[model samples]
Target: MPQPLIRRAGSADADVLTAVGAETFVETFGHLYPETDLRRYLAEAYALDRTRADLADPAKASWIVEADGEVIGYALAGPCALPHPEVTPDCGELKRIYLRRAWQGGGLGARLFGETMAWLQARGPRTVWLGVWSENHGAQRFYARHGFEKAGEYDFHVGDTVDREYILTRPPVSFSTVTTKTALDEHNLA
Candidate 1:
């Protein structure tokens, strides 16, 4: 397997990131969101121009996980206010965590996640949070495995029908908890 390159995204990487966001989301969430809305959301959220603007923002930090010089996944982290007192006045959120289908296995997801979390934690964020669609059980489990717990809150939308999401978090101080727990779990199983 070729080594996966992990680095902060540059302006040139925006379009690819945006495109991947749409493609991966659709592939992962097609069952929940209709094809039409999924396409619409992908286009709107990952449009080249919109993504460029986001990448250029001083307040945001984005990353691309590359393999053989091609982007296979990306992660976006930025300040956000949700999941109770926002954890900190400067708390950040894991706004996006995506990987192409081909890279979903092979340990790329865990590496990308670890890199993103390290970047955010280095910023001294009090809490890092993200929202996953209510139906994306796979994603929820992935987040949970990394110490993100549901915040017991749901975001609602009033579109053609109601849309809901669960807020999840990994506090900066809780890293040791996760590390110790994982070690214990592994020891028990062994």
Candidate 2:
């Protein structure tokens, strides 16, 4: 396949974003919820109006990956909203990162993650956080490889169903105290 194109998302792309968001969510976690619950969750979470507003928000950043002119994946980052005590206004959250099953294991997810992280830290390093389903071992390991540690746990609601989610955090790195090499090695980014 040709290399996928990754670009910043805008309000005009809301419909496509909404579709891909729902598709990827169902592809990954549909079995975990009841039919009605899953439908309700997807409708609320991937609503076109909500997506358009998020895309237009200056405080958030989103990127979409396309291959053959079709969106195959996306990543979103914004001000932290995780319900952790240590979270502050300056902190950032990686709200979502999803790629179709066909596109997995080809390093595209990592590339998308790197881009989102760069955007989150562009103003300077601050705490970065994410939430992953507690049962999703592969995702947990992936976050660990990126220097995130399990900081806490919370219940994530999907309609009437609730899922245990691990809140992973990457503490802010002060460049003054840590060398570039050390920081890179710490995050396994080098």
Candidate 3:
């Protein structure tokens, strides 16, 4: 397979972004919700207008992965919104990283994650946090592998269904302090 082209997403890419966002999201979690609820949530969350606004947001740093000229995955990190009272102004959040199932085990996710972390770290945020669905063990493990730790819990509303989510935080710059040459060079990280 041709290597996926990864790059910072621009405002003009909103349609493709919305497509991948909604597609990957539904692929991952669609069965958990009623079809009407899922459709409503996708319209509310990943509609073209909403995605265009998101792409235009200065605080949001986004990237897309494409193969054969088709967008298949995306990652976004920016201003933290985890509702913990202790979260400070300096924290940023790993807002979303959605890839088609065909792209899941291919290391594209890690590359995108690494690039996203480097971007957030460049912004000098003290840390980055993410909210993962409590039942999504794979996602929890993925975040753990990326240096995030479960710091707390929160409720996430997907339309009318409330999901229990775990809030995980990682100090973005702290990974730079490590001196392992192979580790740093081989794995893109914080």
Model 3 worst lDDT window (10 residues): 177-186
| Candidate 1 lDDT, 44-155, residue by residue in tens | 6678888898789877789888888777788887777565655676677888888888777566666666666666666453677888888778889878877789886665
Query: Candidate 2 local accuracy as lDDT?
Result: 0.88
Which residue pairs in candidate 2 have backbone atoms (N, alpha carbon, C) closer than 3 angstroms, thus clashing? none
Ranking by lDDT: 2, 3, 1
Give per-residue lDDT, candidate 2, residue 168.
97
lDDT (tens digit, per residue) of candidate 3 on 43-113: 99898998888889998878999999988899888888899886887888889998889877756777777
The predicted structure with the larger TM-score, 1 or 3, is 3
* Highest-scoring model, lDDT: 2
Cα displacement (angstroms), candidate 2, residue 1, comes to 3.2
Q: lDDT of all the models against the reference?
A: 0.72, 0.88, 0.81
Q: Write the per-residue lDDT of candidate 2 for residues 106-171, one digit (tens) a residue.
A: 677777877788788777888899999999998898788777999999999999999999999998
lDDT of 1 at 32: 70
Cα error, residue 91 of model 1, in Å, equals 1.0
